[model samples]
Target: MRKLIFMFFTVVLAVGVISAQDDLSGLTGKKAIKKANRAFNTFKLNQTNGGDDLKEARRVIDYVVKQDDTKEDPKTWVLMGDIYNGFSSFNQAQKVLNPDWENIEPNGGMVAFQAYKKALELEAGNKNALDGLSQIIGSISTAGLDAYEAGDYMGAFNSFRSILDIHDLLKENGAASPLDAEEEYDNQLYITGLAAMSAGQNATAKPFIQKLYDKQYDKPAVYDAMYKLTIDDDVDAAEDVLTKGREKYPDDLGLLFSEINHYLKLEKIEILEEKLKFAIEKEPENPSLYSTLGNVYDKLYQTNYKEGKTEEADKYFNLSKKYYEDAIKIKPDYTDAIYSVGALYYNKAAIVTEEMNALASDYSKEGTEKYNMKKAEVESLFSEALPYFKKVEKLDPNDRNTLIALKEIFARNNDFDTSNEFKMRLEKVESGETIEKSYFQ
Candidate 1:
């Protein structure tokens, strides 16, 4: 009886060990899903660290996936894709353990892409899978662009071709299919055009931009991009693009401004002047158009100044002042134009003062009269500049540059008391101390 009892106990012990082994091997359904989730979280957190912890996370995911519970679980397939999409040393452990990983490309992105593709195949409407796939493809295309910019033609070609594949994928899927269809489409076209441009295939880029234009005719940003692509090689082509864009978007400030800029670049001053005059006629109250005209005058003045045409430079400088004043009249808060006016007067004053100083050093008696006249002219110019600078100070007292300029101007005229007052005000403003309202009044 004792021998039989001992044998029975041994048999029970063996059965218990076998049951435990089966539990580890046969994880399925909900249990497998639960394990996968736990592993996924662990993998995500450890992805940035990249070492043994990552390896352990992959082990957990692999154990669950190998259970072969059900191929119908789209969630499982998606999770698998996520693991592959974010694959690092931890995510690729199973493949590494196998011989195939050795032959896989060194780029982690390509491997991640394959996994995402598989997930998309299992679930066509899977948003996460599609996004992952798009990102991977976009990254690959961007890498190509970097290579091309570095003068690596072959590398750029490969990267651009990968981008083309992504474009094809997006085309096959309708715009409504992706979470961000507009963004995806825009990105795809941009990448396509950029690659073609880098490859010196401007003609190829043209169609991509045209497609984007067709999708959103009023998009000024697209028009600007397309204009840049076509302008250098073909002016007439660029003009046609602008004309069509203008026809569709007559009121687009960006398109109109771009057209004006193009004419200016081609030195078609008459055409540019006509366009600006017409724009001003249409929008008489528009401060920006006046500002643009001021810029043109400023540019002309600079060109003439460099060429030693003093009279012509003065004429354009006066024209610049007139336009800037017009801009300020249209919108009193036009700070940029106000600043420009102040800068013009300040520059004029500096020139006169410099000339006077030079004369005084050479011919003392005659120079005294000239110097006095020049000093009077300088004072007149400063009178014009003072209101604008004061306006700037009022608007932004914290602007140290403007405050310093005010103090220097006051001190230069031997107004020591006023100069000290401005200096004190500056210090008070910087320290967030209050000033008496009576002082300004």
Candidate 2:
């Protein structure tokens, strides 16, 4: 009799469990959405507690979103957004509590954004959807700034781009946008383009960058970036944009340098001197500008001297020497300027020696005296060149050119020991061995 009662009770208990499972499996779309929202609210309110409520919400919402009964309802999509939004906040809370915990959904904010946008599509004036999106913007902005600071540029670009997309949507629907102010919107466009360009997303970056150009954004970097983007396909167009940028921001060093480089690339050295002068005035402390300007004048002197314009050549040679000296004063260790100055005197010495040798044919006493005077002048110039080449060697021991210059100068000065020493050093360096010590000392 006891066995019969126990079996009957077990059968009743099993039937009761089956009924409860049937009720759970046959939940309506509306019931499932309500359950999701309830679970989402519980997770949202106690996010710091860390429980399975958020997981339950996600499961219910995922199932309901595909159901015909609730898929077309704006409330359903809004609930969908709320569920993911809860996930985002809950993840944040979990991270703060446990620093080493991995994020459950790193892109939960973006997921919420799409859900809210879909809600708006279902019902254009959905207040919940609009408010959710506005809130999502702040979350995305934080993510973007963090990514940008970390040098994750593509991630930064995506986060910023989504905010702009939301901004546009808000404006199209005649709703208030945080970026409604013209200046704020323009700045967002500029930054989005900057991030995209840095990520090497040229095709993705073009629209934002080009829009800034069209709108005449008042930043020099915009034009600098625009020039780079346009230069490959249309050089004339690139120059046109850069010229406009320079005109807009005349004192900007970056634009100034871009113009200087452009002229240098075209070999338009005639205009480059003026541009370089402008750059020097803007940045007088820069040694490279002085060196470049010195080179420009040096070239000019050589051209005029070759053409027999002695007065013009003298004028340019003085200017060249002045700028080279200015460069040395700014950076005493500037090897290029030191070498250039040495080369200047060495070249003049060569010219004078050529003139002196020409008098070998004239053997009269007066002619011999004249030859001696020219030879003395040549030696004086070579003496002037000697100290600068020595400094170059001390500064750059491996410089083959300076070694050759030192060898020639010492040989001309009749210092065979020093000249032969440099000759040996040069040969060692050429054979890929370092000279242990200088023989000149």
Highest TM-score against the true fold, candidate: 2
Model 2 agreement with the true structure over 312-387: per-residue lDDT tens digits = 9889888888999899999999999999988888887887788899997899999999899999999999998988
Candidate 2 residues lying further than 4 Å off, grouped into runs, are 1-36, 49-73, 83-104, 201-203, 334-441
Cα TM-score of candidate 2: 0.71
lDDT of 1 at 212: 83
Q: Model 2 misses residue 29 by how many Å? A: 6.4
Per candidate, the number of residue pairs that clash is 0, 0
lDDT of 1 by residue, 1-441 (tens): 999999999999789545423444656655755655665676566545443333343444555555666455556655665554454333245454654544123344555565555566666756776666666664465456556777765566656555555455545554222324567657666656656666777776778777887677446657776887878878998898888888777888778888888887877755776688778877799998887787678777767876889999899899889999999998987777887788778877877778777777756677688888888998999878888877876766556656666787888878989879789878987888865442334
Instruction: List candidate 1 segments past 4 Å from native.
Output: 1-66, 71-220, 226-252, 258-283, 302-310, 362-367, 424-441
Best by lDDT: 2
| Pairs with steric clashes in candidate 2 | none
What is the clash tally of candidate 1? Answer: 0
